[model samples]
Target chain A: MSKLLIEDKEVVIPGQILAEGMDYLPSNGAIREGDNIISTSMGVVSLSGRLIKIIPLTKRYVPQIGDVVVGFVKDLTYSSWFIDIGYSNDAVLSMKDATSDFIERGADLTQYFSHGDYMVAKIANVTKTKAVDITMREPGLKKLYGGKIIEVNPARVPRIIGKQGSMIKIIKDSTGCMITVGQNGIIWLKGPDLKNELIATEAIMRINECSYTQGLTEQTEAFLKERTGGKQHGVHQEA
Target chain B: MAYTKRLDGRKLDELRKVEAKVGVIKTAAGSAMFRMGNTIAYAAVRGPREVFPRSMAKPDTAVLRCYYDMMAFSGAGERVRPGPSRRSKEISMVTAKALEPVLDLTEFPKSGIDVFIELIQTDAGTRCAGICAAALALADAGFSMKDMVCAVAMGVIDGTVVADLDKAEEDYDKGPVADLAMAMLPRSGEVTLMQMDGEASQEHIIEAVELMKKSIKKIYEVQKKALLEKYGGVKDE
Candidate 1:
């Protein structure tokens, strides 16, 4: 007989049995082993219809195509600039994808994107060997200037963004920071002053920590309200 | 004369008191500390990040590197010399092999997962303790693992099979001392590592394996509790 071994939203570690028998299917952080479906990572169990999946608590960033990422320029070659996007493999941003400007052959690529410069780009392609290629040809995608970056656990990014971007909107409106959250968990915040930016950074970090708890949106709103002195403080300042 | 009683006044099949904690190191990707009796081991796991000496990285799978070291004051009888020694090198290799079976690293190809284990105290079963701590840290890091690895040192003293020998038991001079360290996958009861020193009879070796399996179940409970405690998974009884 088919049996459900665990309840939904229950935290399970690797090798913990989620279900027994062939009635259930395993996916994403879970796997089938013989007659039982077992979790392959430390995560929360999610039971959807006949499918069993695990939502991982913590994991490194695995780059995917079309993911907006904030990265730093690490090296410059004649035709491309290498960016470190917190992935194991450095992402390559070639000349044509780097900008809309026409360029001569073997031109100095550093002029367009210099080392230590932070930029927001989207992944264009990833090879079978995990070689990543990023692009900046899209709108709102370009080098970021004078904003500090902070990283959170990549798995918690979805919660930070929240449903319909409401959670991030609360933080942005209160701190008055121009926040750009990359899918890889690297976040950039530029505020009217360093103090405002630091407050926003702290808020985001707090959200990242309590992402798994219930009533997160309300908790975040309360936190932002207190930090901004119960009002939108930097709305008048230039971002 | 027969070794009817344990040196520490414990049952013959009993194990040392085990204490386990996870996320002990703030900077490591995953870190854990495991203590069994007087032997304590701290393990930290880093990466699926870049692998140095790029040539050594495997294209199809991540390299699992383990470094096992004993601190200068960790040794029971004498102060351990700092740095890699012949014994430590061998232990490191074995520890890696013991943990390799449970880890699935194909998704992180061309990278490295480095596990650094330091023994802050020692009585016996140092390698086994290190393996247990490393397994917990790997789980804390959210790596894909088939099962947890639990280990213990089983030995024969004066023809009596014993589980979890401490320094005094290991140094028992009344009879031939046989020290056998084993690492097993708790679920399947598959032996991933089994190293023996000294000598034991065929019957005693078989009995030791059975006792090791039973002892492993207890260690597995501690490991599960440690990982779950970190994420607040434990429910009130």
Candidate 2:
């Protein structure tokens, strides 16, 4: 059986056996070996060995074609709005790709999208010369307002969201706040009181800090209770 | 105008406080974080990986690739977007060239070296800061080089040439302010990379170069001091 290191993490390629007699894999603090296999790139592994595969992380946010993200309108031109997607160049949101609703000519663009107004968008195209175009026509894509935004390392976004939305659901339920996480590392939290908003922010921060751990839902729930002087209410208990 | 004073109330040739640390990231093969005045930069050097793209790969020497990025939160006022801009791309290219003469790329045949510089906070002269930080990181990663390339920026403002320009001083646009940034081999007194912007007379340019020479001398001392502190003064030849 052939085994190789993918990104410095030991992984058994599909149709290959993880080296025998090797159970404990070195932890680089990102991923651990012997973790249950979830998805495979190609074929399934036949032999059992504790091997962990690592995913490369990046600090800059590059817009891949067809990636759904949320961004803020930084500048408005005659035909498009320059969207700040936390990338080097702002993504272009053309009028054709805007909402279906009618937009007036020469009207104050702020009425449609003021500066700092957030909107969920999809990367439609990226040119070879580094022009990025975005669209807001997809379902559940709209402008975001009246929320407290928190930023974190974009690489930890998937970990903060958790599997099947369980972690975010818990935070929303416990704090009674509406939370929306943009894939580009922008998190919006809106609640009645500043206290709940702070709690939600702290919870998200905690998730970002300890993303590798299991049983994070229970840990987050307990953390919320400790921070809020007891359960506030509307916290859903998973069956 | 030749103002006989420093912007930070120090002497004309006084440099801002400089601090450097190595091995900041355990994951990276070599890493360093450095601060000059208010500017902060971090550098990580990785690889001896097989060259890619086939065409750019060198049979006799290892290729060097550099990525210099400025964090959005590094500057005050409006935050910048992450990733490389045109200016940063130019800086990265120049920095790679600055170290090219020093590195013994022949040792790693058909391989490449990657230097990644992240500007955490920028005041002024981030390129120089990045070069200094990258050199330390390269050394920390056990890469052999002839001599460390030290860089510094000097500028002429208000008829007076300053050794190091701060943010405010750099932004002053009233006069024909010119900036001269250079990377030099301290021991050999060889120029590795040099660039000048704005308008300056030949005399002013020569004066700025002299100032940069002095500033780089001090910077070289600091660089050696930092390495000695980290590696116990081994003084790798």
Best lDDT among the predictions, by candidate number: 1
DockQ of every model listed?
Answer: 0.72, 0.03
Q: How many steric clashes between backbone atoms does each model show? A: 0, 0
TM-score between candidate 1 and the true structure:
0.96
Task: Give the number of the best model, judged by DockQ.
Answer: 1
lDDT of 2 by residue, A54-122 (tens): 232222244679877778889999878999886545789988798687878876667778788987788
TM-score of each: 0.96, 0.49
Indicate the docking level reached by candidate 1: medium
The positional error of residue B180 in candidate 1, measured at the CA in angstroms, is: 1.3
Candidate 2: stretches off by over 4 Å: A1-239, B234-237
**TM-score of model 2's chain A, to 2 decimals?**
0.72
Write out the backbone clash pairs for model 1: none
Instruction: Identify the runs in model 1 with alpha carbons over 4 angstroms from their true place.
Output: A233-239
Compared with the true structure, what per-residue lDDT tens digits does model 1 show for residues A78-182? Answer: 888999998777999988899989998878777899999999999999989899999999987979999799988788898898899888888888888888889
